[model samples]
Target: MEESPAAARWRVPPAQTALKCAAAAVFAVLAALSDEPGGLLLAAVATLGSGGLALRDLLAPVRVAADPGAVTVVTGFAGHRTLTWPEVLDVGTDERRRFLSTTRLLEIRTDDDLYLFSAFDLGADVREVADELDRLRAGGPRS
Candidate 1:
């Protein structure tokens, strides 16, 4: 089913989610086959970490969603936090340059905290998402 025309949502893409699950599966196999104690411990840790992340992503697929009234985001471990338009102080993009690469992130600022999301987290370009958020915050049309 399609989302309502009044709201827009974004999530970790299905392919990326599948890749995370696959990595977890590989880690599980490695954990099972590891004979050395150190190797087994390492693999077990990897399995649990990746598996937990995959489960979280699967459970809360929509990382970010916004409507005319409020913006909702998936927070820690499948939890969700909703901020009304009034609570949202700013919607913008941040860029960090490291070595040869630059990372762009969508940032939502509030009185209490600043929430940042990567493209992987939003399943869309950070700039586009920020622009959409700005439009929504301004009571513009949803596109």
Candidate 2:
């Protein structure tokens, strides 16, 4: 049987989500076991923040999916955004450098605004995603 196009959604790897939850659990346990006076407060705060983020990421996740007619982006806390081929003006890659580390990002430009999607969420190479999006916008094969 052939899978539906909507079933081909892309999302952050489950391993990453598991890692975040494990890290948060470790911090939470450390916070509970901390004995230092001032250090205990800081550790507890960090545990709470980390735990919250872990829960959010696990629940919402980050995803990008494409159908024949449109693309969908779900950036966890950022909510969902969709754009049809006609709405897309251009699709390309953008790079950011900080110190010795560099990161590349996928960008989509529409008539009204430009949107950026992270490769982490797409679970694929940023360049590949950008190229595929460009092809899709040009009315090429969805794959």
> Candidate 2 lDDT, tens digit per residue, 1-143?
11254333556767777877787788778878889867778777777777776676676565666655888776446477887778878778889899999899888787877777676666778888776666655666556
- Each model's lDDT comes to 0.88, 0.70
- For model 2, give the RMSD to the true fold: 3.3
Q: Which stretches of candidate 2 lie above 4 Å from their native place?
A: 1-8, 75-78, 111-113
lDDT of 1 by residue, 1-143 (tens): 11477778988888888988999999999999999999999999999998998998899989889888999987778999999999999999999999999999999999998988999988789999998888877888766
Which ranges of candidate 1 are over 4 A from the true structure? 1-3
Alpha carbon lDDT at 6, candidate 2: 36
Q: TM-score for all predictions?
A: 0.95, 0.78
Question: Which candidate number has the best TM-score?
Answer: 1
How far residue 67's Cα lies from its native spot in candidate 2, in Å, is 1.5
lDDT of 2: 0.70
